[model samples]
Target chain A: EADIYQTPRYLVIGTGKKITLECSQTMGHDKMYWYQQDPGMELHLIHYSYGVNSTEKGDLSSESTVSRIRTEHFPLTLESARPSHTSQYLCASSGYRNEKLFFGSGTQLSVL
Target chain B: AQTVTQSQPEMSVQEAETVTLSCTYDTSESDYYLFWYKQPPSRQMILVIRQEAYKQQNATENRFSVNFQKAAKSFSLKISDSQLGDAAMYFCAYRSAIRNSNYQLIWGAGTKLIIKP
Candidate 1:
């Protein structure tokens, strides 16, 4: 199993509340990614980081933002939670492009 | 840009039978990688298999194998002697080999496989 961990396995919050999803890995991986998925929907890349201080927006336009201040930590934050933002957020780390990705259990968010 | 597609949103097979999940991709880069990931009800993305586009030979891991047709842009996962444990949502992914890109994986809509006892 990967050393990656995500906080708040399940979360339910009211609309307009700010929330942050925490993801950390002890594997010292340079590549980290965050994907958003709804029930029976395709996984959409929302944010990614190659290394410390490097972040990029993914294919799907996400209002949330991410920061990579350290190699092991990549957190995603939503400024104003909306009902549409309710989905499963997955965090993954990879040591190399050819290597397999280690994914966290994922955070199931619900905005009411 | 690269895109992966899993046309079969759902599939089923009897226990101990063989089942295949289809995947196709579109890319301009000649060098890249393809992968199959399994997400069980537990919601953990597990690596099932991988295939390097540069290699002509298919990749196999015990009960899992890939039928990769490079020319046809087809990469399918075949689970031999399917087991109940194989039931899950399977995703096909593609990664570019370009130097500038950070090896971002393009994912497909998952195919949920049901194993009947």
Candidate 2:
């Protein structure tokens, strides 16, 4: 099993609250990604990072921001949570392009 | 921009039977990669198989295999002797092999596979 981990597998919060989703991998992979998915829906990429100090927005426009200050960590933060932000957030890492990704179990978020 | 599509929203197969899931993608890049990921009841995404666009041969792993038609822009997965553990959501994904590209994955909406014992 991959050593990657995502804290708070599930969370329920109210509107206007600020929250951060944590993702960490012990494999020392240089690439990391974040995706948003709804039940039975396709996953939408929200953010990705090539390495430390490198971050890019994904195909889907999102209100959340991400940071990659350490090779083992990539955390996502929402300035203000909304009901529309309710969804599952998945974290993944890969060694190189076309390489298989190691994904976390995922964090399921619900905003009221 | 690249896009992956899985037309089957859901599928069902009897235990020990064979089943196939379809997928198609749009991309201008000559070199790319396609993948099949399974999300079980635990909701963890697991890699099932992968195929490189430049390769003429298809890819297979254990009971999972892919029928990759590059010119047709199609990549379909076939599961032989499907088991109850195969019940899950399957996603098709695309990624450009270009070094400068985002390397970010493009995903399909996914198909929910049901296995009947």
List the pairs of residues colliding in candidate 1: none
The segments of candidate 1 whose C-alpha lies over 4 angstroms from its true place after superposition are: none
TM-score of 2: 0.96
Candidate 1 C-alpha lDDT tens digits along B14-109: 999999999999998899999999999966888999999999999999999999999999999999999999999999999887788777788999
lDDT of each: 0.93, 0.92
Task: Give the fraction of reference interface contacts each candidate recovers.
Answer: 0.76, 0.86
Candidate 2: tens digits of C-alpha lDDT, residues B1-117 = 788889999999999999999999998899999999999976678899999899999999999999999988999999999999999999999989998876777889999999999
- Model 1 chain B: worst 10 consecutive residues (lDDT sum): B96-105
**Predicted complexes: DockQ each:** 0.73, 0.78
Error of 1 at B48 (Å): 0.6
> Considering only N, C-alpha and C atoms within 3 Å, which residue pairs clash in candidate 2?
none
* DockQ of the two-chain complex in candidate 2: 0.78
Candidate 1 docking: what grade? medium
TM-score of 1: 0.96
lDDT score at residue B33, model 2, on the 0-100 scale: 90
